[model samples]
Target: MGVMNELIDPPGIGTLTRILTESAPMVEWKQTAATASLLGDLNLRARTDLVADALVADISTGPVPGYTTASASFRAALAAPKFTGWVLWPVSEAAVTLALASDAAEDFNDCLALLAELTPRLTGEFAVRRLLARDMDRALAAILTWTAHPDEHVRRLASEGTRPYLPWAVRVPALVRRPEATLPILTALYRDPSEYVRRSVANHLNDLARHAPDAVVDTARHWLAAADRNTGWVVRHGLRTLIKKGHPGALALFGFPPASVAVSGPRLDQEILTVPGELTFAFEISNTGTRDVRLAVDYLIHYRKANGSQSAKVFKISTLTLAPGESRSISKRHAFRQMTTRVHHPGLHALELQINGAAHGRTEFVLEMA
Candidate 1:
């Protein structure tokens, strides 16, 4: 994410300004003023908005509506050969911002079409989110048709743009609340020939599992009923979140039915995990059930939160099948590295094993700040 922010750095904006100047006759976009205040760690969204704000401000200066003026300016900018890549992110954003200002169905629909055009250059996923928020039903109606569109990028946008929990994109409350809103789109593209499109569809379905597990499972089941060579892969990816959370239906979908098992120690190399150190742990599980049982094995880490509370996070370990009386040893080495996403605090912690949607043994350990 940090590296992506650098893609639209100061020099990149200069290039954007140069392209705008050379591309469109009416686009006299001077990004000089916009670049001045963009000092420091102005995250990716901030950089995109800064540039879009400049475009909207410049193009809408005349009597024309911002949407009308900006849309035309951006459409003209597209004629340039180099008018692609990360620069289009702001352009797509600016187009949507202005189009929504008109509040006319014509402009809103045009904005959707514009995003379809721009998606091939760089994803208009970030920009189209606001449109979905504004008029979900109307936008989704248009997006549904995109699932069958010949262009792979447009098909991908149909699924990717409507994800309920699309990361780095603004939340659409209606979509999150009514998770079924985008199922038709997902259903259509689940078996898409393009891996890119299929990936987005799986992720879109996975997002649904976060809030609407039953619906997600049902959808996966429906897809599985009409199975293809790629259906299993798509369903597996779609159920990833549910699988990680040890959801029974998800585990069952992959034929990992619950079974009786005897678990041994999750013994650690050291009882105390020092900062900038490694923790190696191993455990063994035996299939005590009479029939062979498939397992989805995972490990859980209960880390001490900053406020002295503990939060359990699950990590994927491995998956296997064991016959009755069969046993297997699971071992892993976890590094306690300082990361931007998680801040580690020193205190009591624990490790546990999760097999077949059930947690087995837990071993306590201490975290020390070195």
Candidate 2:
């Protein structure tokens, strides 16, 4: 990615300079058209408003490399007092949109803050989020007030704006790392009168679920019990993966009944491998008796460590709706990579499969570490 020259400069002037430089080349056409539109306006404020409107109209234009089109046009447009108020609003929106389309550079951060100031005036909630996604702290500060704003649009931004992995916006890894701070914000908006705002709250809660499953599950359960169909939809969408894979707490939240399950060793029913490297396992489940049943089958791996202790982590292997006579098989591969899980010491590793809430089967294999 090419760095913007003004990106490295100090905040205020640097941002303005970069905007000017990037927009200078296209200034002639944008400003000329704007000025032409305001030819009959004698009042200064009205003239500025017209210019501001013009800038917004042409904001989607390109940077043209060395050309300073947008920056110059903005300069000419901002000259009118009428355009000033309009200036920040449109410019903020345009800048936020632009930032999402590019990587986070110093210029991007500068643009984000500049745009955030005008958030109170802008009607788009998503725009505020795109800007906030750059810096979690700044985003939290600006939006905390917006949550109380009378405008539903602004209020929604309070929740929608701080989503950890909001689509099209830069992902805020910090927020993802420490999701507790986000709880109050989500709680305030989860039951918002406006469905739009409430939907955002649900999504925010869901985002937190990836790292903090317990929190997400708890919050979602509280919301789903009293939520309407639309609200329920929002909660379900957010919890889709967790529910589909039959997360224990998630299954319980959805009122799924427990069913008996059976899992066999790797490669017996399907292909299997013993790993110092990688392995594959085939898990099968059947409804032995009657009664319609919805069940969740999960697996946990116990890695043997040099210290002779075992470390275990759980993963959802499958969810099934079994009828009077139904059986299903799922094949999964386990890679002994440093990323997913750590293999402490080479020894006999144990695997346990949990059905509903009980451990139903076990398998063991030797892992040799070189």
Candidate 3:
């Protein structure tokens, strides 16, 4: 199995079963073991399903009063040594699913309480999604309070959980329509001392940028006014998509002035390449106008796909300021190695240079199989 698969594979299930059994000694170990064994024949989705199944089996057979009581019992059992970090992901997810199944508001409250302790172990981000769907106002109010919590993980959950487009989780339509609802949470944590929290805030803002560009640009301007190094980093990172698209407002906010530059010397070191080969290219940019100019330089490679089509992927080269009459040379070497993520087919590939989002220089090269 690959490194990623190992995290949720059989060993991970075994560890979770052992911890659960130890945490709640009253749990039916025999039933839990049987459920775990059944997980081996299942794929990823089946494995997660089995985790919930095992939790249900344990709860039914073990001494449990209700969902809230069961939640508390399981949580109490998950003390130190056994449950911690990414290794506990399967267990955490199972617990969250079980908690969400409860119909009682009190049960959800209990789950939220458990998540505060469990989030640092894995993440309560996914768990909170159900709460938001259940009651947006209530969930947002609680999450807003969490933003101020002493624990950076809880603070991060406040932002991460409310993301309009959180990956691997269902989209929050309310947030998608009214992203401003999250501004208060973002405002509280934009300059958070923890890089972990700040990164989440940046990502949250990036997600908002997708549907609410104007709002995001406004926020960027507001944040940039008194940005410390860390806050500035968040603003820049948050504006990555806008930067790539060469949004004039975003560029202007970053002081990347209008295009008063000239680009030349678009050439490839080789016209033909084989698998596992290296392609070297160089270009130069000069500030022809009588003023300093901030520039965002990037290059795109149109890779040949197996189905005789091309897809372009952009890569950043540099971001800099150039004085009047100043020129700079940029060079890059890209490997054409076979990657599991992408299949490279032999064909003519196009290379283009983008300055402030406009394609200025172009070249082509041939890629062949070894």
Give each model a TM-score. Answer: 0.81, 0.47, 0.73
Model 1 clash pairs are 67-98
lDDT of 3 by residue, 1-370 (tens): 3444445565666776677666767666565566555655455544655665666666756666346545655576567565665444445555656667766666666666777777877787875787788778877877788888898998898889899989867667888888788988998899898999999999999999888887898988988886777987898889889887776778778777567888986789999998889999999999998878878888889898878889988888889889999999999988888888877899989899888777878898999999
Tens-digit lDDT track for model 2 on 1-370? Answer: 1232222122422243344445454533344253443435234334334444445445544445211333335445444333332234335455555555554355555444444344454433444655555566766765576667676766766776677887755466677788877877876666677887877787777788888888888878777767765666767777776665456787777766566555454342223334445676776677776776787767777778778777766777766788876877777766775444454566777777777766656777676655
Q: Rank the candidates by TM-score, best first.
A: 1, 3, 2
Please write out the lDDT profile of model 1 over residues 1-370, one tens digit for every residue.
7897877777767766776666554645655346735736877878888888887876776456467666666666677677778867888998998888886669999899989988888999989999998989999999999998999999999999999888889988999899999999999999999999999989998899989998999899999999899999999999998988888888888888787999888889999878989999998889998998989898889999999999998998888999999999878998897899878999999988888678888999999988
Superposition-based RMSD of candidate 2 using all C-alpha atoms, in angstroms: 12.9
Candidate 1 lands at a TM-score of: 0.81
Off by over 4 Å in 1: 1-44, 263-286, 315-318, 325-344, 363-370
Q: Give candidate 2's TM-score.
A: 0.47
> After TM-score superposition, what is the CA distance of residue 343 in candidate 2 from its true location, in Å?
8.6
Q: Top lDDT: which candidate number?
A: 1
Ranked by lDDT, the better of candidates 1 and 3 is 1
The per-model lDDT (C-alpha) reads 0.86, 0.59, 0.77
